[model samples]
Target: MASTIRVRATSSGETTEVQVLIQHPMDSGFVKDAKGETIPPHFIRELTFEYDGKNVFIADWGAAVSKDPYVKFSFKGGKKGDDLKISWIDNKGETDTTTAKIQ
Candidate 1:
Protein backbone atom coordinates (compact mmCIF):
# COMPACT_ATOMS: atom_id res chain seq x y z
CA MET A 1 0.00 0.00 0.00
CA ALA A 2 1.07 3.58 -0.59
CA SER A 3 2.21 5.58 2.41
CA THR A 4 0.00 8.23 3.92
CA ILE A 5 3.04 10.43 4.51
CA ARG A 6 4.53 12.55 1.76
CA VAL A 7 7.79 14.40 2.33
CA ARG A 8 10.24 16.55 0.42
CA ALA A 9 13.71 17.38 1.65
CA THR A 10 16.07 19.76 -0.07
CA SER A 11 19.63 20.51 0.98
CA SER A 12 21.38 23.79 0.28
CA GLY A 13 24.92 23.17 1.46
CA GLU A 14 24.39 24.37 5.03
CA THR A 15 20.76 23.60 5.70
CA THR A 16 18.03 21.24 4.66
CA GLU A 17 14.43 22.32 4.18
CA VAL A 18 11.78 19.76 4.86
CA GLN A 19 8.15 19.74 3.95
CA VAL A 20 5.58 17.12 4.93
CA LEU A 21 1.98 16.36 4.17
CA ILE A 22 -0.02 13.75 6.06
CA GLN A 23 -3.36 12.35 5.06
CA HIS A 24 -5.76 11.89 7.96
CA PRO A 25 -9.31 12.53 9.02
CA MET A 26 -8.38 14.40 12.25
CA ASP A 27 -11.79 14.11 13.79
CA SER A 28 -12.14 16.13 17.00
CA GLY A 29 -15.09 14.17 18.54
CA PHE A 30 -17.13 17.38 18.57
CA VAL A 31 -18.44 16.98 15.09
CA LYS A 32 -21.24 14.64 14.10
CA ASP A 33 -21.37 12.26 11.23
CA ALA A 34 -24.03 11.98 8.61
CA LYS A 35 -25.98 9.82 11.03
CA GLY A 36 -25.59 12.48 13.78
CA GLU A 37 -23.20 10.38 15.82
CA THR A 38 -19.99 11.78 17.28
CA ILE A 39 -16.97 11.25 15.10
CA PRO A 40 -14.64 10.49 18.00
CA PRO A 41 -11.14 11.85 18.45
CA HIS A 42 -8.82 10.64 15.74
CA PHE A 43 -5.74 12.73 15.05
CA ILE A 44 -2.02 12.42 14.84
CA ARG A 45 -0.39 12.44 18.23
CA GLU A 46 3.20 12.79 17.12
CA LEU A 47 5.25 13.22 13.97
CA THR A 48 8.96 12.58 13.70
CA PHE A 49 11.65 13.24 11.11
CA GLU A 50 15.02 11.63 11.33
CA TYR A 51 18.21 12.21 9.46
CA ASP A 52 21.56 10.50 9.98
CA GLY A 53 20.08 8.43 12.79
CA LYS A 54 19.00 11.56 14.70
CA ASN A 55 15.74 13.35 15.01
CA VAL A 56 15.63 16.70 13.23
CA PHE A 57 12.02 17.64 13.77
CA ILE A 58 9.09 16.49 15.87
CA ALA A 59 5.51 17.65 16.06
CA ASP A 60 2.91 16.99 18.75
CA TRP A 61 -0.53 17.50 17.41
CA GLY A 62 -4.14 17.26 18.51
CA ALA A 63 -7.67 17.42 17.14
CA ALA A 64 -7.37 21.18 16.75
CA VAL A 65 -5.16 20.50 13.76
CA SER A 66 -7.01 20.37 10.50
CA LYS A 67 -7.41 17.35 8.28
CA ASP A 68 -4.49 16.44 6.02
CA PRO A 69 -1.98 18.56 7.88
CA TYR A 70 1.05 20.14 6.25
CA VAL A 71 4.30 21.14 7.93
CA LYS A 72 7.55 22.76 6.88
CA PHE A 73 10.83 23.33 8.64
CA SER A 74 14.58 23.59 8.09
CA PHE A 75 17.43 21.73 9.75
CA LYS A 76 21.11 22.53 10.29
CA GLY A 77 22.85 19.79 8.40
CA GLY A 78 21.91 17.48 5.54
CA LYS A 79 23.32 16.41 2.22
CA LYS A 80 21.86 15.57 -1.09
CA GLY A 81 21.26 11.89 -1.69
CA ASP A 82 20.85 11.20 2.03
CA ASP A 83 17.65 9.69 3.36
CA LEU A 84 15.18 11.38 5.70
CA LYS A 85 12.82 9.17 7.64
CA ILE A 86 9.33 10.39 8.46
CA SER A 87 6.73 8.77 10.66
CA TRP A 88 3.56 9.56 12.57
CA ILE A 89 1.19 7.87 15.00
CA ASP A 90 -2.46 8.73 15.37
CA ASN A 91 -4.66 8.57 18.47
CA LYS A 92 -6.11 5.27 17.37
CA GLY A 93 -2.61 3.74 17.31
CA GLU A 94 -2.39 3.71 13.54
CA THR A 95 0.98 4.62 12.06
CA ASP A 96 2.60 5.35 8.72
CA THR A 97 6.22 5.87 7.80
CA THR A 98 8.15 6.86 4.70
CA THR A 99 11.67 7.67 3.60
CA ALA A 100 12.54 10.64 1.42
CA LYS A 101 15.77 11.36 -0.39
CA ILE A 102 17.28 14.79 -0.07
CA GLN A 103 17.36 16.68 -3.32
Candidate 2:
Protein backbone atom coordinates (compact mmCIF):
# COMPACT_ATOMS: atom_id res chain seq x y z
CA MET A 1 0.00 0.00 0.00
CA ALA A 2 3.06 2.19 0.03
CA SER A 3 2.35 3.38 3.52
CA THR A 4 4.90 5.74 5.00
CA ILE A 5 6.35 5.06 8.41
CA ARG A 6 8.90 6.97 10.45
CA VAL A 7 10.78 5.75 13.47
CA ARG A 8 13.05 7.39 16.00
CA ALA A 9 14.91 5.88 18.89
CA THR A 10 17.29 7.08 21.56
CA SER A 11 19.05 5.47 24.44
CA SER A 12 19.50 6.91 27.89
CA GLY A 13 21.17 4.84 30.57
CA GLU A 14 19.25 1.54 30.70
CA THR A 15 16.20 2.72 28.83
CA THR A 16 15.57 3.45 25.19
CA GLU A 17 12.77 5.71 24.05
CA VAL A 18 11.08 4.95 20.74
CA GLN A 19 8.63 6.89 18.66
CA VAL A 20 6.92 5.94 15.44
CA LEU A 21 4.51 7.46 12.95
CA ILE A 22 2.43 5.44 10.56
CA GLN A 23 0.45 6.72 7.60
CA HIS A 24 -2.89 5.06 6.87
CA PRO A 25 -6.47 5.87 5.98
CA MET A 26 -7.81 4.20 9.19
CA ASP A 27 -11.43 4.21 8.05
CA SER A 28 -13.87 3.08 10.75
CA GLY A 29 -16.57 1.86 8.28
CA PHE A 30 -19.05 3.90 10.29
CA VAL A 31 -17.96 6.96 8.34
CA LYS A 32 -19.68 8.18 5.22
CA ASP A 33 -18.11 9.22 1.99
CA ALA A 34 -18.98 12.12 -0.29
CA LYS A 35 -21.87 10.10 -1.70
CA GLY A 36 -23.11 9.33 1.84
CA GLU A 37 -22.15 5.70 1.47
CA THR A 38 -20.68 3.83 4.36
CA ILE A 39 -16.93 3.48 4.13
CA PRO A 40 -15.51 0.05 4.69
CA PRO A 41 -13.61 -0.46 7.88
CA HIS A 42 -9.86 -0.21 7.46
CA PHE A 43 -7.48 0.13 10.35
CA ILE A 44 -4.37 -1.43 11.78
CA ARG A 45 -5.31 -4.32 14.02
CA GLU A 46 -1.97 -5.48 15.34
CA LEU A 47 1.31 -3.67 15.83
CA THR A 48 4.53 -5.06 17.19
CA PHE A 49 7.86 -3.52 18.12
CA GLU A 50 10.94 -5.68 18.37
CA TYR A 51 14.29 -4.79 19.86
CA ASP A 52 17.26 -6.80 18.67
CA GLY A 53 15.03 -9.67 17.65
CA LYS A 54 13.08 -9.61 20.91
CA ASN A 55 9.63 -8.23 21.46
CA VAL A 56 9.64 -4.90 23.20
CA PHE A 57 6.05 -3.83 22.73
CA ILE A 58 2.84 -4.88 21.06
CA ALA A 59 -0.45 -3.17 20.33
CA ASP A 60 -3.96 -4.23 19.37
CA TRP A 61 -5.74 -1.36 17.69
CA GLY A 62 -9.33 -0.55 16.91
CA ALA A 63 -11.26 1.45 14.31
CA ALA A 64 -11.34 4.39 16.71
CA VAL A 65 -7.62 4.96 16.20
CA SER A 66 -6.88 8.09 14.19
CA LYS A 67 -5.16 8.25 10.85
CA ASP A 68 -1.41 8.55 10.70
CA PRO A 69 -1.18 7.18 14.20
CA TYR A 70 1.78 8.04 16.35
CA VAL A 71 3.13 5.68 18.99
CA LYS A 72 5.68 6.10 21.73
CA PHE A 73 7.25 3.58 24.05
CA SER A 74 10.26 2.96 26.23
CA PHE A 75 12.12 -0.21 27.05
CA LYS A 76 14.99 -1.20 29.26
CA GLY A 77 18.30 -2.71 28.09
CA GLY A 78 18.30 -1.22 24.62
CA LYS A 79 21.69 0.05 23.51
CA LYS A 80 23.11 1.98 20.60
CA GLY A 81 23.20 0.15 17.26
CA ASP A 82 20.41 -2.18 18.32
CA ASP A 83 17.70 -2.93 15.81
CA LEU A 84 14.16 -1.75 16.37
CA LYS A 85 11.65 -3.35 14.07
CA ILE A 86 8.08 -2.14 13.73
CA SER A 87 5.36 -4.02 11.94
CA TRP A 88 1.59 -3.69 11.64
CA ILE A 89 -1.28 -5.59 10.07
CA ASP A 90 -4.40 -3.81 8.94
CA ASN A 91 -7.95 -5.02 8.61
CA LYS A 92 -7.61 -4.89 4.83
CA GLY A 93 -4.87 -7.51 5.03
CA GLU A 94 -2.22 -4.93 4.20
CA THR A 95 0.97 -4.77 6.18
CA ASP A 96 3.82 -2.36 6.83
CA THR A 97 7.23 -3.07 8.27
CA THR A 98 10.22 -0.89 9.10
CA THR A 99 13.34 -0.88 11.18
CA ALA A 100 15.44 1.77 12.88
CA LYS A 101 18.69 1.86 14.79
CA ILE A 102 18.87 3.38 18.20
CA GLN A 103 20.91 6.54 18.23
Candidate 3:
Protein backbone atom coordinates (compact mmCIF):
# COMPACT_ATOMS: atom_id res chain seq x y z
CA MET A 1 0.00 0.00 0.00
CA ALA A 2 1.08 3.53 -0.63
CA SER A 3 2.22 5.54 2.37
CA THR A 4 -0.15 8.28 3.52
CA ILE A 5 2.75 10.39 4.75
CA ARG A 6 4.77 12.75 2.60
CA VAL A 7 7.85 14.35 4.11
CA ARG A 8 10.97 16.23 3.21
CA ALA A 9 14.06 16.93 5.28
CA THR A 10 16.93 19.19 4.36
CA SER A 11 20.13 19.81 6.25
CA SER A 12 21.94 23.13 6.32
CA GLY A 13 25.11 22.18 8.16
CA GLU A 14 23.72 23.04 11.60
CA THR A 15 20.03 22.41 11.32
CA THR A 16 17.57 20.29 9.50
CA GLU A 17 14.26 21.64 8.28
CA VAL A 18 11.42 19.19 8.05
CA GLN A 19 8.04 19.45 6.40
CA VAL A 20 5.25 16.93 6.51
CA LEU A 21 1.84 16.44 4.93
CA ILE A 22 -0.59 13.76 6.00
CA GLN A 23 -3.74 12.47 4.36
CA HIS A 24 -6.61 12.10 6.78
CA PRO A 25 -10.27 12.79 7.11
CA MET A 26 -9.87 14.75 10.39
CA ASP A 27 -13.59 14.87 11.03
CA SER A 28 -14.35 16.91 14.13
CA GLY A 29 -17.63 15.16 14.97
CA PHE A 30 -19.52 18.42 14.62
CA VAL A 31 -20.06 18.73 10.93
CA LYS A 32 -22.87 17.06 9.11
CA ASP A 33 -23.20 15.29 5.81
CA ALA A 34 -25.76 15.98 3.09
CA LYS A 35 -28.20 13.88 5.01
CA GLY A 36 -27.58 15.99 8.15
CA GLU A 37 -25.78 13.33 10.13
CA THR A 38 -22.99 14.27 12.44
CA ILE A 39 -19.54 13.19 11.35
CA PRO A 40 -17.64 11.11 13.84
CA PRO A 41 -14.39 12.46 15.20
CA HIS A 42 -11.34 11.06 13.49
CA PHE A 43 -8.00 12.76 13.73
CA ILE A 44 -4.36 12.13 14.32
CA ARG A 45 -3.68 11.80 18.01
CA GLU A 46 0.09 11.91 17.92
CA LEU A 47 2.90 12.65 15.53
CA THR A 48 6.61 12.18 16.04
CA PHE A 49 9.88 12.80 14.24
CA GLU A 50 13.09 11.05 15.10
CA TYR A 51 16.63 11.44 13.90
CA ASP A 52 19.66 9.46 14.99
CA GLY A 53 17.50 7.59 17.52
CA LYS A 54 16.43 10.84 19.18
CA ASN A 55 13.10 12.52 18.87
CA VAL A 56 13.38 16.03 17.52
CA PHE A 57 9.73 17.02 17.32
CA ILE A 58 6.38 15.80 18.50
CA ALA A 59 2.82 17.00 18.13
CA ASP A 60 -0.27 16.19 20.15
CA TRP A 61 -3.28 16.90 18.02
CA GLY A 62 -7.03 16.77 18.36
CA ALA A 63 -10.11 16.87 16.19
CA ALA A 64 -9.77 20.62 15.87
CA VAL A 65 -6.90 20.20 13.44
CA SER A 66 -7.79 20.63 9.80
CA LYS A 67 -7.83 17.84 7.29
CA ASP A 68 -4.64 16.86 5.51
CA PRO A 69 -2.54 18.76 8.02
CA TYR A 70 0.77 20.34 7.03
CA VAL A 71 3.55 20.84 9.53
CA LYS A 72 7.01 22.40 9.39
CA PHE A 73 9.79 22.43 11.95
CA SER A 74 13.55 22.63 12.27
CA PHE A 75 15.96 20.86 14.57
CA LYS A 76 19.68 21.02 15.25
CA GLY A 77 22.36 18.47 14.33
CA GLY A 78 21.25 16.55 11.33
CA LYS A 79 23.66 15.45 8.64
CA LYS A 80 23.14 14.93 4.96
CA GLY A 81 22.10 11.39 3.97
CA ASP A 82 20.99 10.62 7.49
CA ASP A 83 17.54 9.26 8.15
CA LEU A 84 14.55 11.01 9.71
CA LYS A 85 11.72 8.82 10.86
CA ILE A 86 8.15 10.06 10.89
CA SER A 87 5.13 8.35 12.34
CA TRP A 88 1.59 9.07 13.46
CA ILE A 89 -1.28 7.30 15.16
CA ASP A 90 -4.86 8.28 14.68
CA ASN A 91 -7.80 8.16 17.06
CA LYS A 92 -8.95 4.95 15.41
CA GLY A 93 -5.59 3.28 16.08
CA GLU A 94 -4.58 3.47 12.42
CA THR A 95 -0.91 4.22 11.92
CA ASP A 96 1.59 5.03 9.21
CA THR A 97 5.32 5.59 9.26
CA THR A 98 8.03 6.57 6.83
CA THR A 99 11.69 7.48 6.71
CA ALA A 100 13.16 10.35 4.79
CA LYS A 101 16.80 11.11 4.08
CA ILE A 102 18.26 14.45 4.91
CA GLN A 103 19.39 16.20 1.79
Candidate 4:
Protein backbone atom coordinates (compact mmCIF):
# COMPACT_ATOMS: atom_id res chain seq x y z
CA MET A 1 0.00 0.00 0.00
CA ALA A 2 1.11 3.53 -0.68
CA SER A 3 1.34 5.70 2.44
CA THR A 4 0.87 9.43 2.56
CA ILE A 5 2.00 11.90 5.20
CA ARG A 6 0.94 15.44 5.97
CA VAL A 7 3.02 17.73 8.11
CA ARG A 8 2.38 21.18 9.52
CA ALA A 9 4.77 23.37 11.45
CA THR A 10 4.35 26.77 12.98
CA SER A 11 6.77 28.82 15.02
CA SER A 12 6.10 30.64 18.22
CA GLY A 13 9.00 32.75 19.34
CA GLU A 14 11.80 30.20 19.79
CA THR A 15 9.74 27.04 19.63
CA THR A 16 8.15 25.34 16.67
CA GLU A 17 5.11 23.13 16.97
CA VAL A 18 4.91 20.23 14.59
CA GLN A 19 2.05 17.93 13.77
CA VAL A 20 1.78 15.03 11.36
CA LEU A 21 -0.69 12.53 10.01
CA ILE A 22 0.59 9.21 8.68
CA GLN A 23 -1.50 6.90 6.54
CA HIS A 24 -1.34 3.16 7.28
CA PRO A 25 -3.63 0.25 7.90
CA MET A 26 -2.10 -0.54 11.35
CA ASP A 27 -3.58 -4.00 11.38
CA SER A 28 -3.07 -6.08 14.54
CA GLY A 29 -3.36 -9.47 12.77
CA PHE A 30 -6.19 -10.43 15.12
CA VAL A 31 -9.02 -9.13 13.05
CA LYS A 32 -10.69 -11.33 10.53
CA ASP A 33 -11.20 -10.26 6.98
CA ALA A 34 -14.47 -10.57 5.09
CA LYS A 35 -13.35 -14.05 4.03
CA GLY A 36 -12.75 -15.10 7.68
CA GLU A 37 -8.97 -14.97 7.36
CA THR A 38 -6.82 -13.18 9.84
CA ILE A 39 -5.39 -9.92 8.58
CA PRO A 40 -1.68 -10.03 9.27
CA PRO A 41 -0.17 -7.30 11.33
CA HIS A 42 0.88 -4.28 9.34
CA PHE A 43 1.78 -1.27 11.41
CA ILE A 44 4.45 1.29 11.65
CA ARG A 45 7.36 0.20 13.83
CA GLU A 46 9.23 3.45 13.90
CA LEU A 47 8.66 7.07 12.97
CA THR A 48 11.24 9.82 12.97
CA PHE A 49 11.05 13.56 12.56
CA GLU A 50 14.12 15.50 11.57
CA TYR A 51 14.90 19.17 11.49
CA ASP A 52 17.89 20.41 9.60
CA GLY A 53 19.35 16.88 9.36
CA LYS A 54 19.05 16.38 13.15
CA ASN A 55 16.60 14.14 14.88
CA VAL A 56 14.01 16.06 16.86
CA PHE A 57 11.41 13.46 17.70
CA ILE A 58 10.92 9.72 17.37
CA ALA A 59 8.10 7.32 18.10
CA ASP A 60 8.14 3.52 18.53
CA TRP A 61 4.76 2.15 17.55
CA GLY A 62 3.15 -1.23 17.26
CA ALA A 63 0.03 -2.98 16.00
CA ALA A 64 -1.88 -1.57 18.92
CA VAL A 65 -1.69 1.84 17.37
CA SER A 66 -4.62 3.13 15.37
CA LYS A 67 -4.67 3.45 11.62
CA ASP A 68 -3.67 6.81 10.15
CA PRO A 69 -1.86 7.83 13.30
CA TYR A 70 -1.42 11.45 14.16
CA VAL A 71 1.61 12.72 16.06
CA LYS A 72 2.22 16.18 17.48
CA PHE A 73 5.42 17.54 18.96
CA SER A 74 7.54 20.63 19.30
CA PHE A 75 11.21 21.59 19.29
CA LYS A 76 13.34 24.65 19.78
CA GLY A 77 15.40 26.67 17.30
CA GLY A 78 13.31 26.04 14.24
CA LYS A 79 12.32 28.84 11.92
CA LYS A 80 9.96 29.20 9.00
CA GLY A 81 12.46 28.21 6.35
CA ASP A 82 13.95 25.17 8.05
CA ASP A 83 13.55 21.77 6.46
CA LEU A 84 11.41 19.18 8.20
CA LYS A 85 11.45 15.54 7.21
CA ILE A 86 9.25 12.73 8.43
CA SER A 87 9.51 9.04 7.70
CA TRP A 88 8.12 5.73 8.89
CA ILE A 89 8.96 2.03 8.66
CA ASP A 90 6.20 -0.53 8.97
CA ASN A 91 6.25 -4.09 10.27
CA LYS A 92 6.03 -5.38 6.70
CA GLY A 93 9.36 -3.70 5.95
CA GLU A 94 7.65 -1.04 3.88
CA THR A 95 8.81 2.53 4.22
CA ASP A 96 7.70 5.99 3.09
CA THR A 97 8.92 9.49 3.68
CA THR A 98 7.83 13.08 3.07
CA THR A 99 9.27 16.54 3.59
CA ALA A 100 7.81 19.96 4.25
CA LYS A 101 8.94 23.47 4.96
CA ILE A 102 7.94 24.92 8.30
CA GLN A 103 5.13 27.40 8.04
Candidate 5:
Protein backbone atom coordinates (compact mmCIF):
# COMPACT_ATOMS: atom_id res chain seq x y z
CA MET A 1 0.00 0.00 0.00
CA ALA A 2 1.03 3.59 -0.69
CA SER A 3 1.03 6.33 1.96
CA THR A 4 1.36 10.09 2.05
CA ILE A 5 2.04 12.41 4.99
CA ARG A 6 1.92 16.19 5.13
CA VAL A 7 3.02 18.41 7.99
CA ARG A 8 2.45 22.07 8.74
CA ALA A 9 3.61 24.21 11.64
CA THR A 10 2.92 27.70 12.85
CA SER A 11 4.76 29.91 15.27
CA SER A 12 3.26 32.48 17.58
CA GLY A 13 6.01 34.32 19.42
CA GLU A 14 7.69 31.64 21.54
CA THR A 15 5.22 28.83 20.90
CA THR A 16 4.55 26.57 17.97
CA GLU A 17 1.78 24.27 16.83
CA VAL A 18 1.98 21.45 14.31
CA GLN A 19 -0.57 19.64 12.20
CA VAL A 20 -0.25 16.38 10.30
CA LEU A 21 -2.25 14.54 7.67
CA ILE A 22 -1.60 10.88 6.91
CA GLN A 23 -3.04 8.81 4.10
CA HIS A 24 -3.17 5.01 4.31
CA PRO A 25 -5.60 2.15 3.82
CA MET A 26 -6.25 0.67 7.27
CA ASP A 27 -7.48 -2.68 6.10
CA SER A 28 -8.99 -5.24 8.47
CA GLY A 29 -8.85 -8.95 7.79
CA PHE A 30 -12.53 -9.43 8.63
CA VAL A 31 -13.56 -8.44 5.13
CA LYS A 32 -13.93 -11.04 2.36
CA ASP A 33 -13.08 -10.74 -1.27
CA ALA A 34 -15.47 -11.33 -4.13
CA LYS A 35 -14.45 -14.98 -4.12
CA GLY A 36 -15.04 -15.17 -0.35
CA GLU A 37 -11.36 -15.19 0.48
CA THR A 38 -10.46 -13.59 3.81
CA ILE A 39 -8.41 -10.48 3.39
CA PRO A 40 -5.31 -10.11 5.49
CA PRO A 41 -5.23 -7.50 8.24
CA HIS A 42 -3.11 -4.53 7.24
CA PHE A 43 -2.91 -1.34 9.24
CA ILE A 44 -0.48 1.08 10.73
CA ARG A 45 0.83 -0.17 14.01
CA GLU A 46 2.83 2.75 15.33
CA LEU A 47 3.43 6.42 14.71
CA THR A 48 5.98 8.83 16.14
CA PHE A 49 6.70 12.53 15.97
CA GLU A 50 9.79 14.45 16.94
CA TYR A 51 11.04 17.99 17.02
CA ASP A 52 14.72 18.76 16.82
CA GLY A 53 15.58 15.21 17.78
CA LYS A 54 13.29 15.30 20.83
CA ASN A 55 10.38 12.88 20.93
CA VAL A 56 7.10 14.72 21.01
CA PHE A 57 4.22 12.36 20.34
CA ILE A 58 3.67 8.66 19.73
CA ALA A 59 0.59 6.61 18.97
CA ASP A 60 -0.30 2.94 18.69
CA TRP A 61 -3.12 2.18 16.35
CA GLY A 62 -5.37 -0.79 15.64
CA ALA A 63 -7.49 -2.16 12.79
CA ALA A 64 -10.55 -0.30 14.08
CA VAL A 65 -9.21 2.93 12.67
CA SER A 66 -10.54 4.12 9.32
CA LYS A 67 -8.60 4.33 6.09
CA ASP A 68 -6.55 7.42 5.24
CA PRO A 69 -6.27 8.60 8.79
CA TYR A 70 -5.49 12.22 9.57
CA VAL A 71 -4.16 13.41 12.92
CA LYS A 72 -3.52 16.93 14.17
CA PHE A 73 -1.67 17.78 17.32
CA SER A 74 0.47 20.49 18.89
CA PHE A 75 3.37 20.74 21.31
CA LYS A 76 5.70 23.14 23.02
CA GLY A 77 9.48 23.78 22.63
CA GLY A 78 9.29 24.36 18.87
CA LYS A 79 10.83 27.32 17.13
CA LYS A 80 11.00 28.58 13.61
CA GLY A 81 13.30 26.56 11.36
CA ASP A 82 13.43 23.61 13.72
CA ASP A 83 13.26 20.21 12.09
CA LEU A 84 10.14 18.12 12.65
CA LYS A 85 10.20 14.41 11.92
CA ILE A 86 7.33 11.97 11.66
CA SER A 87 7.52 8.22 11.23
CA TRP A 88 5.20 5.22 11.11
CA ILE A 89 5.31 1.43 10.85
CA ASP A 90 2.72 -0.89 9.38
CA ASN A 91 1.61 -4.37 10.36
CA LYS A 92 3.37 -5.72 7.27
CA GLY A 93 6.68 -4.62 8.82
CA GLU A 94 7.07 -1.71 6.42
CA THR A 95 8.22 1.69 7.71
CA ASP A 96 8.15 5.22 6.33
CA THR A 97 9.36 8.59 7.60
CA THR A 98 9.28 12.22 6.57
CA THR A 99 10.65 15.50 7.89
CA ALA A 100 9.70 19.14 7.64
CA LYS A 101 11.07 22.30 9.18
CA ILE A 102 9.00 24.96 10.86
CA GLN A 103 8.76 28.05 8.73
Candidate 6:
Protein backbone atom coordinates (compact mmCIF):
# COMPACT_ATOMS: atom_id res chain seq x y z
CA MET A 1 0.00 0.00 0.00
CA ALA A 2 1.06 3.58 -0.63
CA SER A 3 1.36 6.29 1.95
CA THR A 4 -1.70 8.39 2.69
CA ILE A 5 -1.50 12.18 2.45
CA ARG A 6 -3.95 14.89 3.40
CA VAL A 7 -3.78 18.65 2.92
CA ARG A 8 -5.80 21.46 4.40
CA ALA A 9 -5.57 25.15 3.76
CA THR A 10 -7.26 28.16 5.29
CA SER A 11 -7.12 31.68 4.00
CA SER A 12 -7.35 34.76 6.13
CA GLY A 13 -7.11 38.14 4.43
CA GLU A 14 -4.18 37.62 2.03
CA THR A 15 -2.39 34.65 3.51
CA THR A 16 -2.99 30.95 3.36
CA GLU A 17 -2.10 28.45 6.02
CA VAL A 18 -1.57 24.86 4.97
CA GLN A 19 -1.39 21.74 7.01
CA VAL A 20 -0.25 18.35 5.73
CA LEU A 21 -0.57 14.86 7.10
CA ILE A 22 1.44 12.04 5.58
CA GLN A 23 1.15 8.45 6.68
CA HIS A 24 4.46 6.58 6.55
CA PRO A 25 6.50 4.15 8.57
CA MET A 26 9.55 6.23 9.33
CA ASP A 27 11.81 3.37 10.29
CA SER A 28 15.00 4.29 12.11
CA GLY A 29 17.83 1.78 11.93
CA PHE A 30 18.61 1.84 15.62
CA VAL A 31 16.55 -1.00 17.07
CA LYS A 32 17.67 -4.58 17.53
CA ASP A 33 15.51 -7.64 17.57
CA ALA A 34 15.69 -10.63 19.89
CA LYS A 35 18.25 -12.02 17.44
CA GLY A 36 20.35 -8.88 17.80
CA GLU A 37 20.02 -7.91 14.17
CA THR A 38 20.42 -4.27 13.22
CA ILE A 39 17.44 -2.60 11.70
CA PRO A 40 17.86 -0.31 8.68
CA PRO A 41 16.90 3.34 8.85
CA HIS A 42 14.27 4.41 6.37
CA PHE A 43 12.53 7.75 6.54
CA ILE A 44 11.30 10.63 4.52
CA ARG A 45 14.12 13.03 3.78
CA GLU A 46 12.72 15.79 1.62
CA LEU A 47 9.41 17.47 0.94
CA THR A 48 8.51 20.12 -1.59
CA PHE A 49 5.42 22.20 -1.96
CA GLU A 50 4.31 24.26 -4.95
CA TYR A 51 1.47 26.68 -5.38
CA ASP A 52 0.21 26.99 -8.92
CA GLY A 53 3.54 25.75 -10.30
CA LYS A 54 5.62 28.10 -8.21
CA ASN A 55 7.88 26.76 -5.48
CA VAL A 56 6.46 27.69 -2.11
CA PHE A 57 8.27 25.62 0.50
CA ILE A 58 10.79 22.87 1.06
CA ALA A 59 11.69 20.82 4.10
CA ASP A 60 14.52 18.46 4.92
CA TRP A 61 14.01 15.89 7.64
CA GLY A 62 15.92 13.15 9.36
CA ALA A 63 15.38 9.94 11.31
CA ALA A 64 14.40 11.96 14.38
CA VAL A 65 11.12 12.63 12.64
CA SER A 66 8.15 10.56 13.80
CA LYS A 67 6.24 7.95 11.93
CA ASP A 68 3.16 9.01 10.01
CA PRO A 69 4.61 12.48 10.08
CA TYR A 70 2.38 15.54 10.08
CA VAL A 71 3.53 19.03 9.18
CA LYS A 72 1.81 22.38 9.35
CA PHE A 73 3.02 25.35 7.35
CA SER A 74 1.67 28.55 5.90
CA PHE A 75 2.44 30.74 2.91
CA LYS A 76 1.32 34.00 1.39
CA GLY A 77 0.05 34.84 -2.13
CA GLY A 78 -2.33 31.90 -2.38
CA LYS A 79 -5.92 32.68 -3.14
CA LYS A 80 -9.14 30.73 -3.39
CA GLY A 81 -9.18 27.94 -5.99
CA ASP A 82 -5.41 27.85 -6.40
CA ASP A 83 -3.84 24.41 -6.49
CA LEU A 84 -1.26 23.32 -3.98
CA LYS A 85 0.93 20.37 -4.93
CA ILE A 86 3.15 18.54 -2.51
CA SER A 87 5.77 15.92 -3.21
CA TRP A 88 8.00 13.91 -0.93
CA ILE A 89 10.86 11.45 -1.14
CA ASP A 90 12.03 8.90 1.39
CA ASN A 91 15.49 7.67 2.19
CA LYS A 92 14.64 4.38 0.55
CA GLY A 93 14.06 6.18 -2.75
CA GLU A 94 10.30 6.01 -2.62
CA THR A 95 8.27 8.98 -3.76
CA ASP A 96 4.72 10.19 -3.22
CA THR A 97 2.66 13.21 -4.14
CA THR A 98 -0.64 14.86 -3.30
CA THR A 99 -2.52 18.07 -3.95
CA ALA A 100 -5.05 20.45 -2.42
CA LYS A 101 -6.82 23.59 -3.55
CA ILE A 102 -7.03 26.79 -1.62
CA GLN A 103 -10.40 27.74 -0.30
The lDDT of each candidate is 0.94, 0.89, 0.94, 0.89, 0.83, 0.86
lDDT of 3 at 35: 98
Instruction: Select the stronger candidate by lDDT from 2 and 5.
Output: 2
Give one digit per residue, the lDDT tens place, for model 2 in 7-77.
Answer: 89999968999998899888998999999999999999999998877888999999999988988989998
Model 5, 1-103: lDDT tens digits are 4437788877775777778777877888899999999889999999899887788889899998888777777887688887888999999997888888887
Q: Write the per-residue lDDT of candidate 6 for residues 21-95, one digit (tens) a residue.
A: 888878888877689997789899998999877888998999889998989988877988878899999998989
**Per-residue lDDT of model 3, residues 9-52, tens digit only:** 98999999999999999999999999999988999999999999
Each candidate's clash count: 0, 0, 0, 0, 0, 1
Q: Could you tell me every candidate's TM-score relative to the true structure?
A: 0.97, 0.93, 0.97, 0.93, 0.86, 0.88
Error of 3 at 46 (Å): 0.1
lDDT for each residue of candidate 1 in 18-43, tens digit (9 for 90 to 100): 99988999899899989999989999
| Worst-scoring 10-residue span by lDDT in model 5 | 1-10
List the candidate 6 regions with Cα displacement exceeding 4 Å: 1-3
Clashing pairs in 3: none
Candidate 3 Cα lDDT to native: 0.94
Whichever of 2 and 3 has more lDDT, that candidate is: 3
When sorted by TM-score, best at the front, the candidate numbers are 3, 1, 2, 4, 6, 5
Cand. 4 TM to true fold:
0.93
TM-score of 2: 0.93
Cα deviation at 61, candidate 4, in Å, is 0.3
